[model samples]
Target: MVAAALSAETTRAALFLAATVGNVLGALVNYALGRFAIRFEDRRWFPVSPLARQKAETLFARYGQPVLLFSWLPIVGDPLTLAAGLLRTPLTVFLAYVTIGKAGRYAALLWLMPS
Candidate 1:
């Protein structure tokens, strides 16, 4: 928000792009964690509790892929990204929706911020 709000005219668009890209990359990390980390979930030291994982899985199962549009949300967003991986969402589809949602969010922020 600060970066979008305070960026100079020459760099504002670049900043916005950077922010969106960074956020999407972070989500990718989360997705990778979900995809690659699930084997350890059966172990005792895994981060998320079983109930939390179940809830995330249930939400993903119920809503399907379009639900990823909400991945720009605050609390629910990160979990949904991870859930996408855990549930075996196709990579291309995941990137398309996630990029759309994340870029849209940054675009909105840039539009709303005062010049």
Candidate 2:
């Protein structure tokens, strides 16, 4: 959808803004879902494992919040966004980092598409 919009003669800045807003809103929804999952964290059906939890903790401790820049990544991206909510990342910080990452991803996709 974003690629189609960008290819329709929309200004790059406008497309970027729109894509960023929509993508960030979607991620925020995911974050809210994650926050809700806190109620079920101890259930047997919960998805995370001990090893994965340890790794995520270590990475956050070692790398700090800058690791959020890679939230645009595919398989790992959604989980990272969820983790941000699970860890209660500040709203301003989450918005800034996630927007940067998502905007960069959309910009790259637009750039690589044949003009």
Candidate 3:
């Protein structure tokens, strides 16, 4: 990012694209992992209780989209994407929200840098 900020305008744009694409790809991976975890959801050994599951589903249904806008958060961000996948958030929706959040954060940081 510092390199980009210190480089030409085109370089900054390229760096922004690289950062956004890479971050989004990572979010996709986490989402995929969450999707994979679902295979074990119904197993007797699964950790979540039925009531807990229902409550989680309810919360996600109600607030998931809005919450996803904050998926740019550091440590907390990854789990939000994972939860979105576990709750069966559509791919397009996940991408849109995750991209917006992540890209917005990067954009802000880049903007904050000296030109």
Estimate every model's Cα lDDT from 0 to 1: 0.81, 0.73, 0.76
Error of 3 at 26 (Å): 0.2
lDDT of 1 by residue, 4-33 (tens): 367564566787788889989988887887
* Full candidate order by lDDT, most accurate first: 1, 3, 2
| Clashes per model (N, Cα, C within 3 A) | 0, 0, 0
lDDT of 2 by residue, 4-105 (tens): 664687776687788889989977875665677757656786555545555655666678777778777765566666677778888789889989999899
Residue 68, model 1: Cα distance from true site in angstroms: 0.9
lDDT, candidate 2, at 68: 75
RMSD of 3: 5.3
- TM-scores, all candidates, are 0.83, 0.72, 0.74
Off by over 4 Å in 1: 7-10, 42-51
Give the per-residue Cα lDDT of candidate 2 at 88: 86
Q: Candidate 2 has what TM-score?
A: 0.72
Tens digits of per-residue lDDT for model 3, 20-69: 89999988886886678757756796444455555545656778676778
Pitting candidate 2 against candidate 3, the one with the higher lDDT is 3
| Candidate 2 lDDT (Cα, 0 to 1) | 0.73
Q: After superposition, how far is residue 44 of candidate 2 from its true place, in Å?
A: 12
